[model samples]
Target chain A: MAALGFAALFNVPARCLPIIFLFGAVGIFVKLLLLLFGINIVFACLAGAAAIGFLSIPAAHYKHAPPLIFYIPAVIPMVPGIMAYRMMLGLIKLTESTQTLNYNTVLFETVNNGLKVLFILISLSVGVIVPMLLMRKESIKHVRVPFSKK
Target chain B: MDQAIKSVRREEMKQLGKVLLKAGTMLMSAGANTGRIRNTINRIASAFDYSVELHISQRALSLTIMDEEESSFVSKLRRTPPHVINFTILSGISKMSWNIVQDNWSSEQILADLERLEKMPHYHRWMVLSLVGLAGAGFCALANGSPMDLLFTFLASFLGLFVRQEAVKANFNPYLAIYFAALTASLIAGGAVKLGLGHADSYAFVTSVLFLIPGVPLINSFSDIIDGNIQNGITRGVNALVISFSIALGIFTSTFIYQFQ
Candidate 1:
C-alpha cells in the first residue's frame, strides 16, 4: 500500500526513474524503521527526511530541478493520510450522535482518533522541519560569494 | 560588453529592485539552498555589472551592489543601463559550482550528514505522522467505517494542490478555491460511501488535511526564527497558521453544509 502511494506520487513527466525508485525504496524503509523502533512519529518523519536529503546528494549533483521532488515523494509515506481521514470520520460521527443515536461509543472513538491525528500531524511537521532547520544552519555559513566584485 | 545602456529614473530603478526582491524571495521560498541562492544573486548582480556583496543570515540574504549607477531592470519592459553583461554567464557558472560540490563530497560524508540529521528532533514528527496516517486507515477499517471515504480523502488531498496550482493564475481567491476543492472531495467520498464502493467515513477527517498540511512553511518559519529572521519567520509562521485554519475551515464548512442538507 505504501509503495503504491509512493508510485502514484511520481506522476511527473521527465523525472529520472532510477532516482525515483531509489527514493521510493528509502521512503518505505524509513516508514518501516518508524514502525520497528516504536519511536514518536516525528522522529520517523525526521529519519525519512534525512534519508531523502542524503539520497538527494546524487540528484543535486546531476543539476536536475531542486531536491524537493526527491525528498517530497520520499516523505509521502509519512503524510497524515489515514489520520486525517479518521479525524473527519470521527467529527462526522460526533455530529451524528446528537440525534439520540446512542453514540457514546462512537463519540469516544471519535475523540480518541481525533487526538491521535492531531498529535501525528504535529509530530510529522516537527520531524520534517527540524532537520531542515539544522541543514539551513550548516549551509548558511557556506553561502558566501567567494569573489564579491565590489 | 561595449555599449552602456542608458540609465533609467530612480523610481524605475526602485521598481527593478522590488522585482529582484520578489524574485529572491520566491527562489528562497522555493527551497533553493543558500549556495544556489548566493550564486543566483551574484549572477543577477553581475548581469548589470554591479559588484555584489552578500550578507547571509538565518532569516534572509541581503545583497548590496557597489556600483550604484548601474540601473537595475527586473521587468522585461523596463529600459536599463547598458553594462558589460557578463553576469548571465556567471549565474550559469554558479549553478555549475553546486554540481561540482556535490561531486567532490564523498559518499561517506553524505552518509554522515544523514546520520547526524537522524538525531534531530524534527525527524520524529514526520515518522509519527506517517505511522498515524497508515495505521489510522487500518484502524478505521477495523472500526467499520467506510473505506471509500479513506480512499477519496487520500486521493483528494494528494491532488488538491495541483488543482489549486492551476486555479491560482485564473483566480487567486484562496477561500473560494479551497472551498470548491473541499466540496469536490466530499462529493467523491460521499458518493463512494452511498454507492457502497468502500468505507465512507473511516479516515476522511485525517486524510482531508494532507494537502493542507503546513509542514514546509512551518519548518521554514521555524528555521527563519532560529536563524535570526524574526520578522520574516514570524510572518511565515503566521501564514502557516492561517493556512491551517483555512484547511480546518474548508473541512468544517464542507461537512456542515453536507450534513445540514
Candidate 2:
C-alpha cells in the first residue's frame, strides 16, 4: 500500500502498481528480517534495496519499462523519513537549548540522526544501482509486452 | 540526381533528429535518469541504422545523430520540459522504442506514437490524493503511531496534498507548493497535538509531512553522481535540498506557533 501510494503519486503506469507493491513489501520484509537478526541498519537497508533492484530487472524486461520505473518508487518507502524528521526536530531543539549540557545532548542527538539518515540513503542508492552495474548485459534484453499486438 | 538524393536524405535525418530530441526531452522531464534517456534514445536510433551521442544536462538535451558512414549528421539542442514524475511516459516510451526497433518503424510513425504517448492520462486526482494520504498513514503506522495518530496523519496528508495540487494549479512555484503542503500538513497535525487528541501527536506531525519528501530526486542525485553525471547530480541534489529546507521551514513555523499558544 505504501508503494502503491508512491507509485500513484509519481504517476507510475497503472500496470506497474502491483509489481511495485510486491517489491516494496519484499524490501521492507527483508529489512525487518535482517533487523530481527541484529544486522546493522545500514546494511539491512542496502540488502533490501538490492533485493528490489534485482527484482526490477526481470520485471522491467517483462514489462518493457526501464528498471528505474520499478525500483525508484519501491525504494522510497525505506527512505528513513522518521529519522530525518527526528534529526530536523533535534536541530530545532538544539537551537532552543540554553544550558551547555542540554545543547550538547541535543547536538549529539541531531548529529546521530543526521548521520544515520545519510548512511542509510547512501546504502539504499548504492544497493539499487549495483545490480544494474553488475548485470548490465542482462538488463538490455529485448522485451515484448505479452498481451500487446504490434 | 545526386543532389536531390542528398537533399532527401538530409530531410530524413532532420526529421529523425527532431523525433529523438522530442523523446529525450520527454523522458528527461518525466524524471528519467540520464542513463535511461541515453540508452533508450540510442536504441531507437540504432533501429534506423544510425547512432546518437547525447549530452544531457539538468534541463536540456543536446543530441547529435550520425549515419553508418558518418558522412553527414544532424545535431540539435532542445530544452527539457519541466520535471514531473511520470513513469507512465517513461514506460510508454521504453515500450514504444522497442516496438520501433522490432517493427522497423519510420520516423513519422515514431512521431505519431510519441504524440499518443504524450496524451496518456494520469490516475484521477482524488485517487492520488487519498492514496497518498493513506500512504502517510501507513508510514505513521510503521513508526508505531497510535490509531489516533494514523487518523490524524491521513487527514493531514489528504488535505495537505490537496493544497499542494491546488497550489500547483494556481501557478505557484513548485517549491512553494511543497512549502504550502508542508505547512498545511504540519498545521493540522500540530493542531491535533495541541488538542491532545492522539497519543502520538508528534508521530502524526512527523509522518503527515513525510509524503512531501523528494525521495526520487535525492536518490536520482546519488545515482547520477555515481554514474559520472556530476553536474546533473549536483543540480538535483541542490533542488532536493531546497525542497527539504522549505518543508522544514513550514513545519518549524507551525511548531513555533503552537508551542507558544
The TM-score leader among the candidates is 2
* Model 2, span B192-250: residue lDDT tens: 88898865438898888989888888878988888888989899999999999999988
Worst 10 residues of 2 chain A by lDDT: A141-150
My TM-score estimates for the predictions, one after another, are 0.57, 0.95
| Model 2 TM-score, all chains together | 0.95
Candidate lDDT scores, in order, read 0.49, 0.88
lDDT of 2 by residue, A1-150 (tens): 678889999999887889999999999999999999999999999999999999999898777678898898898889898899889888878777799988998899899999999999999999999998888865443332332234
CA lDDT of A51 in candidate 1? 69
Structure candidate 2, residue pairs in collision: none
User: Residue-wise lDDT of candidate 1 within A1-150, one digit each (tens)?
Assistant: 332233233232233435655675675578668868897655675666666766665474374444444554455446555555555556666775675555777777777767766665455444444554556545434443443334
